[model samples]
Target: MEVAIDNSEFSYLPAQAEALGVPLPPVERLTLPLADGRTLSALRFGSEAPRVTLLHGAGLNAHTWDTTALALQQPLLAIDLAGHGDSSWRDDVDYTPRTLARDVAAAVEAWTTQPQLMVGQSLGGLTGAALAASRPDLVSEVIVIDITPGIDVTAGPAALREFYAGPTDFASRDELVDKAISLGFGGTRPETERGVFLNTRMRADGRVEWKHHFAHLAAQALAAHDPGSATAPSVLHETGWDDLAAVTAPITLVRAARGFVSEADAADFQRRVPTARLVVLDATHNVQETAPVALAGLIESATPARRI
Candidate 1:
């Protein structure tokens, strides 16, 4: 059951870059100390001060943006949100966007010299909105991918809910990959295997487990399923309208055709943030993985020539 493999998280970067036909840039892992004694980790993708900052969704780490970063080829920082990836978990397990934004704000302020284009997906999108609102000085512009405040938490893809609601540990990496595939997640076998390798660790007890704390939180949420539970993470149902409205930076909402943000949700977003721009792509929830090139193009286009 114990899988013996290289524990390096960056080992797959070459293949990822090769697939996108981009030269591998000098990448390094960064760990910044949070005031709470926990650490926030991130991947810095170039030598220069980052022009862009990326935030991954719940249950995902900075590696989820590998392909997108490859296509960007720009100096970028991809942060591992609190309780996710290499970041230290919280004692309260409160992974709401508002709480997460505080940590992300700290990372941005520490990593970038000035305002940067902030891109986020799923839970990270909401977090980005919150950050833009609270710390507009850190974000020159914001790109929220495939998520809207209006989305119904209980209406997300059933397969995804089931996957997160299932067991968090597996006997081997293959077992986890197989489970993800069976649950209609993680894409193809090879892709799923690569994801499994990056997103899991071999515990001392000879078992593989997800690296993010959201997995356990999601399981508990599903198990409780209490009607109108206010204590549940805001990633579940909290409408981030106020955050989006308060954001002084320009906003771009990218809607994946096959993803969670429906036309109605997109319309609502437009209504709430009339100054924001909306884009639609032919992709699923994980647009960065499925459509990185296009997503990178969008990011490049949205980035301003001059930072504020």
Candidate 2:
């Protein structure tokens, strides 16, 4: 089947940069072959060796960090975690942070020349912690946005779960945009449209479907069983805390005021890593999307001089 996938993923960079009042830099998509014949994909934001490496949350692609990358204006790589974006889905569906960290480590080694300031959100945050623990040489500093090992599984917005529980394929991209807007997801109509365009593809069957594997898997699960009984794959596990504890890099925990991490969770994080810095932002769970400039500022401050 001939599926028509939009290859011009970077076409919207100019507008994104313009909106942020930043100069658009050279952006390119890079793919690396994994050991199992699967591939990892990422967006290289500048021509220089990347100083930072970003990982997006569950159900999001690398482009989710586009605005944040623009605002930062530094050499960076935004990776498409396995089973999301252009990265190959795993046959085993083992998306635990420890498992995902292995692939992220591979991308970092291939795409970056030196240790990078690792920034990750939600699921990506956990993965970053795991990577820092397992491969300290690749991550010099780590920033975890709006997530911790203690996050409540049921704390996520119900609307988000409902959105994924809907049909996997839609009649048009606009339909998905409309659905997201109604569910109180994306920021604005134009922003939602752009996000939809980047995150979905046209199937050979003439329908539009999400590029991430989790959404499709959730929809399939819901179709086979009662909606109340079926849910998305769990990203949380007990070992996440051990990974956080084992990290050797400098740690900064950014908690979204209105997001999932609670005061208790933040307290627990501080207790676990007494030397870690913590900051709270007034935004939702998806801080990269909701608070890109502010998030970028944090990344900028923490970023050190580029290493040769």
Candidate 3:
């Protein structure tokens, strides 16, 4: 599928330049066509060639990287993977990493023919691994944020599963924001509120619902599959290891000291992929939210110099 850069729905506004004391560059909303006839939406932070591309975790969107992007203040593109943000939802409920990687690879190819640094968090990390392995021509480096192929997937994602398993619609936006804060989705009150606002939209029915399709799609897939069956993301873990092994690019695994990726997992990753570099910080799973400046520094270090 080809990517078409459109400016109809969103445009770069100078007022959005400063965030969290970081001077953000201009941003533009863009869209690309997916192979399955769905559209992938994204935000471009600079007009310069997209030196870096960011993919958020499951259920989140491009806005999740707002603070990190602002801190980076470099030419980067943040994508709303399929079934998230303003992107088109899939009728088949195929949110597997391989499927998502094809869409991302297409967008990268459209954005630039040269190899660019790729960053992903959780689900996005799995997708980035798949892309780096499959389309080495498009990705020069891979940064997996607080997630790895050998992550403890059994009980670690309980919070995420519980959050998405609940009702999708909210009586009011404030209600949703309150719920996110209570769930510890963000570090501070204002951050939680902004996260809720970014992830939701007003429906024609005058009700507020999450813009991401993970909850609804997961429900559908769960109902159709047998009880005790692995969810769609099981393939992510199954194939992610292989993807990491196949990647030719220099890889960096940013592990949160207090997060799901354990020291044992990090050791195993190093053993499996010798080129992988591990960096640990004192934080939780959502390191981008709690440690944007540090995360930005990691990204800058992994990124290659800009092409003239």
Best by TM-score: 2
Indicate the residue-level lDDT of 125 in model 2: 92
Write model 2 residue lDDT over 1-308, tens digit each, in one string: 33443668788888888888888988888889999999888889888999899999888899989889899989999999998888888888888899999999999888888998999998999999999999999999999998888874422456766888868889999998988999987777998899999998888888888888888777777788745433457776688889988998999999999988898989999999998999999888889988899999999999765421
Q: How high is the lDDT of residue 105 in model 1?
A: 88
lDDT of 3 at 217: 52
* Model 3 lDDT, full chain set: 0.76
RMSD to the true structure for each prediction, in A, is: 3.6, 2.1, 4.1
Question: Which pairs clash inside model 2?
Answer: none
* Residue lDDT tens for model 1, 150-231: 8844335556666766567788898878778888776679888988888888888977787887666666676677323312
11-36 in candidate 3: lDDT tens per residue? 22233344455554667888787666
Q: lDDT scores for all predictions?
A: 0.83, 0.86, 0.76
Order of quality (TM-score): 2, 1, 3
Clashes of each: 0, 0, 0
Residue pair clashes in candidate 1: none
Better by lDDT, candidate 2 or 1: 2
| Predicted model with the maximum lDDT | 2
Please provide TM-scores, in order, for all candidate models, with all chains considered together: 0.90, 0.94, 0.86
- Which 10 consecutive residues of model 1 have the lowest summed lDDT? 226-235
The lDDT, on a scale of 0 to 1, for candidate 1 is 0.83
